[model samples]
Target: MATVARTSMLGRLGDMTLPIGILAIMAMMVLPLPVVLLDTFFVSNIVLSLLVLMVALHSYRPLDFSSFPSILLIATVLRLALNVASTRIVLSEGHSGSAAAGKVIQAFGEFVIAGNFLVGLLVFAILVIINLVVITKGAGRVSEVSARFTLDAMPGKQMAIDADLNAGLLTPEDAKVRRADVAAEADFYGAMDGASKFVKGDAIAGILILVINVLGGILIGTIQHGLSAGDAAQTYILLSIGDGLVAQIPSLLLSIATAVIVTRVSSSHDMADLIGKQMSLRRAWVPVAGVMALLGMVPGMPNVLFLLAAAGAGAMAYFSREDGDEAVEGEVMPGAAPQAGGAAAAPAGGDESSEGIVPEDVTDNAPISLQIGYGLIQMAGGENGALVSRITGIRKDLSKAMGFVVPGVRIRDDLSLPPNSYRIRIGHRIVGEDQVYPDRKLALPGGASVRKLRGIEVRDPSFGMDAIWILPQQVTEAESDDYVVVEPESVIATHLSQVVTSNAADLIGPDDVQALLDNLSKVTPTLVTSVVPKLVPLHTLTAVLRHLLAGRIPISDLRRILEGLAELSGRNLPPIEMAEALRPSLTPLLLQQLGSITQPLPLITLDPELEQILIRARQAGDLDGGLVVDNGLASTVITSISEAADKAAGEGRTPVIVVASPLRRSFAAFLRPHMPDAIVIGINELPDTRRVEVVAVIGGQAGIPAPNGAR
Candidate 1:
């Protein structure tokens, strides 16, 4: 009980320390104090100033001393209060002598100035000038610039943190901490910017107080106390100068502390260690030694001092070089163990060396990978790097669109490719490759423009449109000319997004399918329990999902998909057949992606006669489930659809191919290779309330060949 009481009492005392100190400071400014108490407070003020300075010097970074601004404000106020108290004593008791104020003031006046008032006054003025003019002014400027730049760089830093989080390099909690640090750093610099004004004002007030104390004391002594002119001058000036020195010394310490903090850059080492390590470079010392030795031999120079300094520098350089060589020799390369014979031991197998060879177990490949050459690697991860963040956003958007979690993209560097080239892979297969200049912006010319840009002409990687790779400085000019401008990182990210979206089916497996089922089980347990594994099994469900994804239908509404699957459970239908039956339930999701249900969906339809011809080909090739269309007819059909797609895209509408319900799956497979961007939908998949505007009819043109004997 006694120990607990003692601990509780200490905690309460620690909590009250700030309020008690603040009240005391305020009390000192208003109330009168005896010489002994004033002397004690003055000494305490000097001690606190020194402590603050020492702390600032030892802090590894500015944020390590985040409370310095508040501390500076309180210290400045305390010094000013002390000044007011001392000024009152100095003016009221000047007729008595310098000792009338306090022993501290007396010692500063007599011992420091050697009883010479003019010398004391001159020294006090110089200290004020150094603090206010040089240190305070420079620190204030640094604070202003640091605050502005810190605020300006916040967005870039936040993007970098988010990129790291999405790239799996940092956890959400780690990113949160980093973001808080960035915000705190900005706040610290801003507070410092404002706190510096307190020092400046204190210096100005010190000068005013010194002048008032001296003049006020002289007039009171001579006129009021009937002292002689010389007597008043000696008495008042000595006391006034003494009080000024006492306040000025602490103020000088604080001013130096402020300068040190504002000029500091964040590092792992404190000021002393940082400076010592940087200045220990042997090459730097060697030049200094040679320069000093050359100067020592000059005519009329101080030969002995200069020559001795040069010898010391030469000795430091020689020892530093030896230490560096020893450090280099002591370093052991990874995987190279020293043997009893003082040589590296061979691998256990003895046939092959282990040096620089990566083991098979160490290579873990991601489902989706983006490998860029060295020149474009900078676009992958930095404050300004947008590729990683953009890819993360793409995955999130596609996940929502496709109704499944998109896997993370593993980004790395490949040195074998050309410096400007990048390759995107889906499960070890290269799906897209392109070149981008890091220092350039790509601008696509939409139509005839008033101005033409001079640059390397190239095709946009995502869409194969005509684009120009222009220097960054030309972006504004190109935009003014109505060209669509894109940064190099955006260009690469867009290409990767296209590749990933098209190959999303290849990325999903049984694991992803089971995860969806597990999530659905939480909401409708019986529905999931009856449909998955019990009726269709996990692999069949995965196949159904991949089939839906290949047709550009979202599986986000999994409950409805399961309801459709449950309806067909006993039928034992193929995965493609199951997907076909599920399409009607997923119509609303697809329609939502297109636009409002009330608005007409722009679509391209196949001619009835052409559709019949394709149906006959599919039926004829029924044994293998592959269409056996004539080669010439297939080429003609692809060419006609390609033209229609180009026309649809030109009119600012996506090329969605609408076919009969029976032919939707087979026709989509046939058109996928020739027109990857085309969206194919079955007639039965359209919601009843939805409207359609058929803009083009493929194979309806007069000159196209008939499919009867084109082979």
Candidate 2:
């Protein structure tokens, strides 16, 4: 400390001679001037410096050839006017002598408060630079929205998919294609995300200026008063009103900066996207800025906060604007390969995706296209009411961890926003009804089904397409209401129609089926080939599948569940018969009980018109290779078998689930001779089903259960 002090002293001594020489020269120049005029210049010097600083700092921006000269000229003129004003004040106030004028001169010269203000501003500037640096250097996929500014910066799904593929979650070819797609998609949006922060900082910079100006003003007043060091510091803080703000220059500068930053950030990206509950709800930066602003006002802490607040505001504005869709539309994959289902086309598949890093398949199409997930979310109002179409864009950006948009899938309208009861349908067919209109029983599209609605008052003559809710109970199954024959592809939407028509299910989640699967897993390993394995309870499983559309249950675990079910019914059941033992009606109905948890269950991906098409194709033999397993056809066939086998033997009514796949046929044939107690059939052959009723079969013909080697 002593050595540093000695060095500073020596440096000061060297500079002291220059000040003395300048003073002597100044004295000579003023020797011939009258005392009043000369004193005026002295007093105004400090004032002029303050004025210049105020003007310079407030209107700062990138200098250009066109505007620089004019700015300088205006500044010069302003300084001159300030000097002239000071002279007039001194003369009119009748103040005299250098002693009294000295006070005014000292006010301009005092650096005590100004020094503190400047130091505070410098600290703020450094922090902003540091924050920007920290953000730019970081990488990875995370939600685009997060409460804390520093805690977000999530790795995007594209990045995540790449990592997963690289880690061997996918095939090489799939990885290559996905990598290209994610890269292009994430890069386009990522650029905008990154650039927005600077605008936020710029906005905050305005607040910084205002804070420093306040401190600077107080310091000048304190110095002019010529008080003791302790008193001068206290005066600026405890008694000052920031007289320099008389021009309100700092505040105006801040306002403009705020506006510009907001505009700039908003212009750069899709801002109205869901920032996740974390960022959009918590607003962490707002408090941080508020605190900093308060501190900045304190001279010691004011400047930093002011700038931080401005920057944060800028960022918020950028992230919150929902205006242009043009930018998002323009963001095409620059050199991306086509997407092939969920596989990557890389050498060793690894690509970031919504479901994490996974391998992808190479697409035969879209070699250079980016796949952006957007929703065609179903919109339904009251019975025949006007449906409000709402589309959520840029939701869950995940890049900044600021949002949680499901990757490659638009889940924006999955959950109800502005929560209220609304009707759901599968085209004209009403599938969901229990919760939709619990009190009203109106006719639906095909015939009549209006019992799902709730929290609504249905009138007797609220006519729309001639449906009536007069009963306030069940919608009588209409004669024309043919079974909704649909394929696996369109299962969810069709099932959703059931919810709309029957009021059979509600929103479901992951834990709904945890119990059923857990119990099922304890019985036998191969009993169930589940899509999602974690589900356990019957209702839970149903609900999970209902929402997620797919779920898994280990083969062993599924047997366990069957065994447990057998135990519940006090029957010694074998694994082969358990699935059949679960009444066909019961199994499908259980999905409704699970509410939304039913998953891993086959999704009906077939189109609404697909059944008709397939039927026609079957008649014309023109489908090339598509099958038609229309609605209730399987059930009606099962009923025929049940009635034939009137003497039932198992749980409720024993069902024979014929192995209709070719793979199972060959295997079942091998075991047929040894295991006579449990019947196994082949697709190519049929036995005397008159004695042993041919109950129900999936994936096959009436007589032939399955092909030789394609179980």
Candidate 3:
């Protein structure tokens, strides 16, 4: 019933802006007619008229008329039906069959003066309205029913009331005239609605109305009276005028109730109050009824009566709602139904939806299961709110996995980052969320397309955009799509002038590093010095090299390099995913060196022959100044030789090394501390140097430089 009632209300309101306006204009138009005209046609009961009209509107609301004319026709016919019904009731209120026969003369006399004696007085009014509308139809387009209502029936032109223009029917001119009729109707009914005070979210108006009606009813009953026939008739006539105004009060209340009820009903809830018991109806309707009921009742305990009436009406509205298998789509409010997947049958193997994705979207696109490999970061934070602070959560996770007593190193998950730091993307592209897709196929609204940072194409949605997906687009280096640019807020960011560096040591090769860098100036590069800092037992550079070679670079020491980058650049560096990248290639060699720790010769370190290779490469027009670019093989070689030879010579030890190539200049620089007192150059790169006194040859357990065992 609540559903029905509410639906009924909605259906009416859906047409709300119009029909009531028509009724208002009609009533107002007839208002100035003398009492004879009112008594003759309108039939003297405004309250009943309103109530019947409202009920007709409520009933007609659900009818299947797609156009304005159909609605008007239905409403017009409904009004006539209501009129005839009211008349039958009016007639039945009087006497019996014999009295009717004797009253023929009186009936005739009454006809000459009053009019209809059959049925009810309301019937006459319905006929008049119906006749009027029928007559207006023939009046030609020059003057339509709405125009007559405007020009002859009433005044003022408001288009909002009867705007039937949007339905894609009817000419513009007809609609222009129709506006006034619609507005007048709306104003008449809207006035009552505005005065009803029901929809203001609480029932203060209903309470007030109940009070006023009861008191007013009693007061009017008190003020006017008579006992005799003619005198009583006159007294009643006088009271009827006041009754006319006060009678509409209940209709106003009825309007409030009807609207809320009908809406729910149309929504498939038969009653108006399906809003539920958890909510109170008195709170809704009391404003319109409470005070009025109190006013109508005697001043004694009117509040109590008001409360009872409100409670009763509210309860009726709540529980009397229509039930069903059918409900309107929009009526299904939130929290009224099970949440998505909440009640869904659990999938086989329990719920794997811990991440909460639609089952359809989850696929192989998700990341594979893998253990944490390694990570590093270059920059550091000097103070507060730097980029370093946001990492607290990650640190917590990592700290938990590795036990507490590892090295007393504080792995900060947080830093003092700036409020507006950028991820430094290729273009400032924004992908809304995690997608399994790579960007190239994801076209923008404006016909733009994105390409991957690398030429490698991906079709999965997961690989698409990220909040962190900005790259400062640099030129692609060779066949690879890898870009090299300055960091956004780092010291390097301002100088991001190139796509790749001539000397990028972060990528590869312990062995290659030695071969590539052997000829560099005696000036040391930070990579070797920082990792193998010269100290006593710790940094004897030998033990340190061994430790590092064995992959025992402590977290404390690793953090120093990270701190240096930060101190040098004053920027937020991301956790180095690149450091972990190194572990795979670097780990094996480190392990091998560690296993053979007992060899006194320290054969793991680079000899001068390898250093000579780097020097020749440098002198062979292959070096870019002191740096090597795009030479992974060369860079790796230089780095390895530099590290090995540096560690050996740190103890003031030297090796008689073979050399041929243009490396003499570079070797002089690399071995500056252990400046070899005597060198037996390798006979291979040397011309007949076998006859030379100091020939360096690698033989037996190890090679030694003999002083002229030749010649």
Candidate 4:
């Protein structure tokens, strides 16, 4: 029972350690401490400062020591409190002897300054200058800049996380973790910006306290003890210098630690490993060795010291080269034999050889891919790389608009392409290709340029608009001429975005369908369990979704789609028939995409007689070949619709084709080859809350009349 009570008491003390330390620091400022306790606190302060510096040195990244700001505040307070306790003791006891305060302070005065008060004062001043002027000021500036940049980059980082989530590269949990990290990074830098001010204030406080201690001690010694002026100065000044040094050394250490944390770059390696790897190159050491050797041979130089330094550098260079060669050989000769002429050869049919062989039947292609040539590889990755981030943003925007998660794009280099060209592919087939100058900006004329710019002219890859590639220096001139400026990476990302959106139906397969169902099951388990594999098979639902996606309809509202499926559960219908049956239920979603529901939908209508004729033709099996139309009539209809679409686009409204229920699908199929950008919707697909305005009528001229009973 006694042992158990002792264990419990120890656990409670561990929990209360921080509060106890804080209370003690506060007490030291108000209450007078004995010389023994004062000495103990000063020693502890030195140890704590050293511990903080060591931790900062070993941290791989700033975030690895995220609690540093709080620790900094605590250490600064502890040191100040110790200074107060030491000053009280020093002033009261200096008249007795140099050893009056404690052995710690006396040892610092007698040994560290070599019993010279002037030397101690100069050393203390230098320490104060180094800490306050150089390290503290620089650390404060870095903290301010880091905080500002971190805030500026938060939006971009957030968009990148959303992109990764939409591309299926990150799950919801992983995205949450990443977003938290971004927030934490901002908070840390902001705290560091404030914590640096504490170090600066502490340096100033140290200077003031030193002066106070010396002046107070002199007056007290002369007036109360009746000592001579010179004797008083000798006694008080020595104690003052020792007290200042003891406090300032720890202050200096904390300042250095603060500087180190604010300046460290986030990397995989710690400080020691990073410095060693970068400075251990043979090429770097060889020049140092040659320079040192040359200096050693100069006439008046210290011959022995310079020669010894040169020899050391040469030895380091030789060892670095040998290590590099051994590393290369190890990489090249894994399970390989040494051949003639010192070349390493792979062992035939060995495990290492087998690892290099890929099976011919393997088809490991990304659903979408972007391939850039060698000249643009630098734009794909680095601190300033915009291509990868731009592509990620594109994927996120397209996914939100299309109502489905787009697959991640795989980027690589293809040497067969031209140096400035890039290709976007879906599966194994190239869908779009373009050329962009990585070093120049593309300027497109909005209207007519104020003056013609001299540069290589090309068509915009995504929209085929006429544009000129101009030097970065010409951006001002081009913009002054009313040209819209675009970066090269933005152009490529835009083209890739278009290609992926147009082929969205092809990207979703059985696997993607099942993943979506699994996610839905987590929220509405009963609905998924009752509908899938019971009423409608999984493939049927996938096909229906694909049909909608092919027509550029968003399937993001999965619950609505499943509800529609459940309503028609008993009937065994074909996929196309099911999709047609489900169209009316999805009319609101489609209308929301066009614009606000309060506005009228701009539409082009088909003549009743012409619609009937197309319906008869489709019923008579004309879909397999083509719509039943002569060359002249087909040309006339195509021309009329194209003119109406251009007008609608000019008015900032999407062009939609409205037809009767039975004729909608067939008429859309007929118009697709001619007007790929037009949207075709059935009359029943229009919701009652929406209004319609007929912008134009197709197939209503050249002797084609409306049917008698047509509205």
Reference-based lDDT, each prediction = 0.81, 0.32, 0.30, 0.80
Best by TM-score: 4
- Consecutive 10-residue window with the lowest summed lDDT within model 2: 395-404
Across residues 1-711, which tens digit of lDDT does each residue of candidate 1 receive? Answer: 999999999999999999999999999899988999999999999999999999999999999999999999999999999999998898888788779999999888887678677888889999999999999999999999999999999999898777655543454667899999999999999999999999999999999998998888889998999999899989888888889889999999999999999999887799999888667768889989999999899999998889999999999897663222211011111111111111122346756656677764245467887767767756764456567666766766677788887777766666567889989888779999999999999998865566779888999888877889999899889988989899898898899888877888898999888877776787799988887778878899999999888878888888988888888988978998888889888866876776665666766778889889888888888643467798788887778877666665765666567788878878888877777766778887877776677666767342232232200
Cα lDDT of model 3 by residue, 1-711, tens digit = 999999999998989756775665455433433323323333323444455435434442322111322333333333333233322322232122212212321232243324322222243224333322332222222223223443443333332213223321223556665664455444433332332232221123223332343344333434432134433332222222222222223323333333432222232222323345323433445454555565547666666766677666655545532322111111111112211101122456965756876654332121111010011121222232112222222222222222111111111111122222212111122111111111212211111223444432223122111212232232233113322222222211211101011111111234322322221213345544443322111222222223232222222233333234324332322223223222333333322322232322222223456444455556664343142223554445434444434444444333334444234334433433232222222223322212322333332223343343433
Report per-prediction Cα RMSD to one decimal. Answer: 10.1, 22.7, 29.0, 8.8
The weakest ten consecutive residues by lDDT in model 3 span 366-375
Task: Rank all candidate structures by their lDDT, best first, as comma-separated numbers.
Answer: 1, 4, 2, 3
Q: What is the C-alpha local distance difference test score of candidate 4?
A: 0.80
lDDT of 4 at 303: 77
Instruction: Give the residue spans of candidate 1 off by over 4 A.
Output: 1-15, 32-72, 87-123, 138-196, 212-246, 249-419, 424-431, 437-459, 465-490, 503-599, 605-640, 659-675, 695-711
Clashes of each: 0, 167, 129, 0
* Backbone clashes in model 1: 0
Query: What C-alpha lDDT, on a 0 to 100 scale, does residue 23 get in candidate 1?
Result: 94
- Quickly count the clashes in candidate 3: 129
Winner on TM-score between 1 and 3 is 1
